[model samples]
Target chain A: MLSEFDLIKRYFTRERAGRASTVLGVGDDCALLAPTPGMQLAVSTDMLVEDRHFFAGADPRKLGHKCLAVNLSDLAAMGARPLAFTLALALPQADADWLAGFSEGLFALADEYGCELIGGDTTRGPLNICITVFGEIEPGHALRRDAARDGDDIWISGTLGDARLALAGYRNEAWLDAASHEQAGARMHTPTPRVALGRLLAEQKLARAALDISDGLIGDLSHILAASRVGATLDVDALPAGLALQREDQALRRRFTLAGGDDYELCFTAAPAQRAAIEDAGRASATPVTRVGRIEAAPGLRLVDAHGVPLALSLRGWDHFQQ
Target chain B: MLSEFDLIKRYFTRERAGRASTVLGVGDDCALLAPTPGMQLAVSTDMLVEDRHFFAGADPRKLGHKCLAVNLSDLAAMGARPLAFTLALALPQADADWLAGFSEGLFALADEYGCELIGGDTTRGPLNICITVFGEIEPGHALRRDAARDGDDIWISGTLGDARLALAGYRNEAWLDAASHEQAGARMHTPTPRVALGRLLAEQKLARAALDISDGLIGDLSHILAASRVGATLDVDALPAGLALQREDQALRRRFTLAGGDDYELCFTAAPAQRAAIEDAGRASATPVTRVGRIEAAPGLRLVDAHGVPLALSLRGWDHFQQ
Candidate 1:
């Protein structure tokens, strides 16, 4: 029988990029990291479990990428640059091929984002992956939820609804051929964390409030409203959807855009005067930015039609622990 | 149904004691930390799963304490003062009483060590808890495994075999009266991490190599020897067993002391010249330290009995994914 030590040495242990932030990594009881001087270290952890987070036969490569990508999205929400991450994994068994593909996907994205894997633990149990990521941001420059003002323009980066649309296709609620299914499924399985845009927001002092839309736009926007003590009026017709989703039934597309979740795009607020600067930022990061709404003094979220009448909402986003 | 957000607000969220190192605590995408000048951040993660790490019906209070204790023990091995920790938890159901008890145990230990609960994730799944801890240590002062040298005296802190005895009693393989059972069971359930001794080792530059004895002395010592490219000579008679265990059969006592685990004590190597200072550290920390053997230049472990005759062994310590 191959031992756990051999499994780690063969699968988890690899040559690091010699990141200056990582002083010591792996092997020891604890890995050592040196946070950049005068910068605060931002840390967050997210866990994914089999069946709950994904189907049993989901691709190991995509699963691994999604696990780390979601955590990186959290760092993006806080406008922090990627530093390092630790992964704690539980597996039913050590499948060498599965581990190889998983590591390939994990390291690919990590290398692209300049985030190094520093330390982690692997054990025998039902499949579970928990990643804790570290990033850095200057003091008091973080794009906080409580910082949004009454007149700030609410903005979103990249298109929405694709991941949810893909999920709908997977469950057979929508029709799609092989290529279309693959496109949408890819969105659901592999999310590109908006790291560059987030850094731009922090460095250029663009956003007053920001977060990635993981839960549906409505539920997540409520967080900012509650934190900032403000309300919002979203232009329903202006909501951006993936090209495939936009061509679907308008009502279904609207539901996917408004209430469907799993999108890892940054939604943020900035003063109305910074619209041109927002465009420059979007261009600089090569990500699309859409004006979705405006922060208001009212206390409740209102979805306005073209004539400005509010629409009623009955659908809810996914919530953990809601059985 | 209680939402994950509501659960975090109701249970996990709390006011933090203002530590200069913690710039931001919970209630955000990520927590922010500030490492002290010129100090490296030491990080480690450990995961515990139901039925694998502990019995299914184990008390949640002690389980919580053990969860954090095990991770803190990793920091103790590195001689780091714990700064903060993140708890990623999965629960089958939200039992309020269980959560209350678990939080109580977690907070009590965190408060004692000044290690704050910073941030983490909560989700519905099979029972699991993963804790990632961060602490600080100065450069070039960390007690590393590769630093052990020939002639270094091998030292053990606190008593061993009690936890193993508790396990034997639980399995009905050994006879322990009620009082004795509880005594040994407490050792298994609430092993006190030797944090002070590790810090003393780093500060005083006494230990050449160090690690906690979670996987039995023989197995964990091999980790040091392999990393250092050295070997060890153990004086089997000098190995310490708890008073209760010592009263058992001599062979049973030796096996438990040698092969049994879950002893969160320090197994470290130090120069024989530091004997006086080692004693002073022990008195100052009020923790017993015992000289068990010496590091050898040869490439394998040798265990000698009272008359210096070598004993042979074939058993190995627990490995999570042996298959």
Candidate 2:
């Protein structure tokens, strides 16, 4: 079997992008980076574990892509541009084919966003992938959850609930046709990070506060509400649903749309006057934005149906242990 | 049982030291950092898995200290002054006492170095600790393994082999008196990262190449030689051995000094002309400096005894998998 050092050099080492920002890459004790002048560094870390975060025999390529994607999504929520990231990986053994597929998936998305794999650790252990990504943003431009204001319109990008719909298929909680299963599985396995949209909103200063939905819309949005000391009222009918949800019952669809996690879409709030600007920014970035809710002066979140009747959700999201 | 979020909030959150450099830390999607002007960012990552890196029932406090210390050791190897670090931890369950002990150990060392625990992720999984630390260094001042040159005097900070001596006792390969076992065990469990010495050397432009002894002196030194395309002849008699080794036989002592890992001492090389400067820097940092060997023009390493005869040692060092 190849040694840990050999495995890292063979699979993880690649020509780094953003050479000016990354002064040093892999093969060193520490990676050296030079953030652009006058920019603050944005760093976030996320970890994925086997069986808990993924299946035992899940595709390695997709797994790699998803690991980095989750971290980049955090950066997106902060409206930070891509800079570089470090991966700390643990594996059961040295599997060349698995590593080849994994690195390929990781690099493909990283190249797309111009985020380089700066440095990482590989060791003999259970399958665990932890990524710490660093990015840079102009001073005072980072979108934060504490910045939301009452009366601001809340907007969500892209479709939601498909990933959860896919997860349901896996758990045997719900059934879908093979075609729908395939589409939903793709969403569950590989979600796109809305970096461009987030950057545009942040650079334009159109969003008051922003966050990416990882633990479902209601739970994640509650974070923003709590941080900002405000509440929100979501127009449930306006929530975007994927085609996979078209045939589901209203109750099931509402459950999926409101609390289905794994959607890497940005949810942001903007002042009422900034509607035109937000639309312009979305068009420029080629990302669709839907106005799904509004921040309120009240101190708790509420969901209203089309006729203005409130809806109740027993389980807002999956809380790894609490559930 | 506490939720992951509750556990982090209770234990890991502490008042950051370099607040001026941190725009936003903990409780945010991404922690923001303001690097010192014109300085490059130095980053490194290390992971410790239960049973592989530590005993299953090891003291939580010591394990926490060692996890961060290992990463700091890497930064020290590059002569980077640590600024901040992020921890990604996995746990089988949220035991409050364990977290309290772990956080206490981690914060104690972090406070000593002014290295803040900026952010982290805690999840439900097998026990694993991964830390990625960030530091700063002037553009050309960071010591590197590839920069070693022929005729440079090799130096090591502090003693070695005690950690392994403790391991041998645990493995029943050797015997240690009660006092000796306790001392060696502490060394193995909680190592002192040579941050002060490393910073002094880099700031004074003393060391040509440097790295912390991690997987044993011989194995890690091989990395420096292979990277620099140079070799060295070590005076085995000059190799510093911990007090625990004084009672061991010559062969056992030599093996421990050469192949024993877990000594977080800095092994560095400097130009012969800068010997006085190295001495001054070592004095300023209050870290003992020992001259152990000389860099040779040739491309292979050797050990010489007091009489100048070559020593043939069969085992180079421990490889995590090969062993």
- Best candidate (score: lDDT): 2
- Error in Å for residue A255 of model 2: 0.7
- Per-residue CA lDDT of model 2 for B59-102, tens digit only, reads 99998899999999999999999999999999988899999999
Second chain TM-score for model 2: 0.98
For each candidate in turn, the TM-score is: 0.98, 0.98
Q: Which portions of model 1 show Cα errors greater than 4 Å?
A: none
* Recovered share of real interface contacts in candidate 2: 0.69
Per-residue lDDT of candidate 2, residues A9-128 (tens digit):
899887565479998889888999999989999999998999988899899899989999999999999999999999988888888999999999999999999999999988889999
Question: What is model 2's interface RMSD?
Answer: 1.0
Predicted candidate 1 versus true structure: per-residue lDDT over B24-109, tens digit per residue: 78877789898998899999999999887888988989998999999999999899989999999998888888888899898899
Clashing pairs in 1: none
**Which regions in candidate 2 have their CA more than 4 angstroms from the true location?**
A16-18, B16-18
DockQ, per model, reads 0.81, 0.79
